[model samples]
Target: MTAAKVLVAYGTKNGSTAGIARTIADALGEQGLRAEARPAAEVLDPSPYDAVVLGGALYAGRWHRDAVRFSRRHRRALSGRPVWLFSSGPLDASANKRDIRPVPGATRASMRLNAREHITFGGCLQEGAKGAVARMIVKRGGGGDYRDAGQIRAWALGIARELTDVTGGP
Candidate 1:
């Protein structure tokens, strides 16, 4: 039997969300799934994967535009798969401390795709990040890498287990 192929697609600002997506892909691969990470904007099709993990970076309580468009653009293909959604924002410890609900955009996408789950991970802002607001945050010393790699890996592993259980593959 063949292993399930998973897509870890993300929309990111300052590249932090992309990092998380890569981590997820790596973890899923470690669990015996074939997973790849790609920018949400670059993926023209979602039908090739058995499962999809879609994520976006949040700003001002909104998900990234690319992620939003991806969900709308590939709704038909995605709806038929086991889909998971995530938001990467909250540039503080709050995300680790509590369960941060999805932004309105993510919530709507989840509903539209019948996503299996949604998560909000801590965001990162640092020097050299694009945009005036990001630079300002960094200048004010409010920027840092807050993503928890362990948590991200655990999430991906859970997905791997679910996928493997259903597929009867390693």
Candidate 2:
């Protein structure tokens, strides 16, 4: 039989979230699953995949529009299959950071679909990667890369384990 296929779809602005999606896909691959990371807009359909991992870049405490639309548009398939969601935009280690607070309005769709998990991870800030407003804000706040690869890998391993529990193998 063919290995289980997983889709890691994300919406990103400065590419940090995309990088995270790629990392997750790689981790899942290491766990013996077939996984591919794709931009949310390019994913025409999620029906072909056995599982879906959806993520988005958070701005103004809200998920990106493309990610939101993908989740809502594929809610039926997503609800029937295994789905995990993540948010990338907390630029700090503090879990209580105000800027990274959950966006209730933006989470309605994911919550409605009953995602297996919704994790918020720290984002990165690089000079020239963003527009004038973002540049000015990062300049004032002191920009630096805050993502933790180990944490991401651990979470993905957990997902792999969950899938194994249900399907009996990664």
Candidate 3:
């Protein structure tokens, strides 16, 4: 039997989230699922996929505007399906590996849609890629690329396993 299709939709400002989405999609594909990564704004409908992995970059405890918009616009359809949410913009300077909760916008949508999971990943900070406010924050927070590929791959694999259990994909 063919595996269920999964959509890995993401919203990004400096493109880190997009890269993460693509990496997740690739990892999912390796785990025997059909997964496609696309910008959340480009997806007008959530009807085509059996499962969704929605993610967005977080800034000051807020999700990207497009991701929030997509979640709101597709809330009805999304509620009926298996959906997962992720936040990909936390600076991991400290050793704390506690789960990062979704932003307020995402939390509301996840409640309405009953999203299955919400995972937060570390983000990257470039030299000159941020706005003035963000730049200042980065200067204060210290800058570096904090994304962990192994962690991301493991998360994607777990999601693939969950999808397979739910859909009985081959």
Candidate 4:
């Protein structure tokens, strides 16, 4: 079978989410899949890809507006293909397993895509690197980098496995 084309689309504030997306794309490539990581803004037309991985950095309990809009705009094309959604948030380790607050608009819009999975992972909190409100919150909350590279790689591998099952090869 021809290698499946996978697009890993992402949005980031301080670049952590972008890093995660790159890791995911790299993992998929290592598995002999054709994968490309691109920012949500630059990734036009989901129609060309066999699979799509949509991701964003969550801010104040919501995904980036652009990422949400991208998914909504390409809902039709995405629905006909395999889609996966992921969010980078919850910097507090204690908040890691907690259910992510509903991203109502994004979730509703993404329903049209019939996304196969939605994964939420811990993110990084970089002081002085975000908007005023976010900076204040991080300062008051005593921020830390909560991103786990190992966990991110594991999830990417799992997603690759699912893709292999769907496409019929490892």
Report lDDT per candidate. 0.92, 0.83, 0.84, 0.80
Which candidate has the highest lDDT of all? 1
Ranking by lDDT: 1, 3, 2, 4
In terms of TM-score, the best-performing candidate is 1
| Model 1 bad stretches (over 4 Å) | none
Clashing pairs in 4: none
Better of 2 and 4 by TM-score: 2
lDDT of 3: 0.84
Error in Å for residue 109 of model 2: 2.7
TM-score of each: 0.98, 0.91, 0.92, 0.89
Per-residue C-alpha lDDT of model 1 across residues 49-160, encoded as one tens digit per residue: 9999999999888999999999999999886789999899888989888998888999999999899999999999988999999899999999998999988888888899
Residue clash pairs of candidate 1: none
Better of 1 and 4 by TM-score: 1
- Tens-place lDDT digits, model 3, residues 31-147: 888899999999988898989999889887898898888888998877678888888887673313777767798897688778888888888777775688668767786666778
Question: Which ranges in model 3 have alpha carbons more than 4 Å from their true place?
Answer: 93-96, 138-141
Candidate 2, poorest ten consecutive residues by summed lDDT:
94-103
Each candidate: how many clashes?
Answer: 0, 0, 0, 0
Candidate 2 runs further than 4 Å off: 95-101
Tens digits of per-residue lDDT for model 4, 23-96: 89999899988999999988778788899898888887788776788887888777678888788877777435
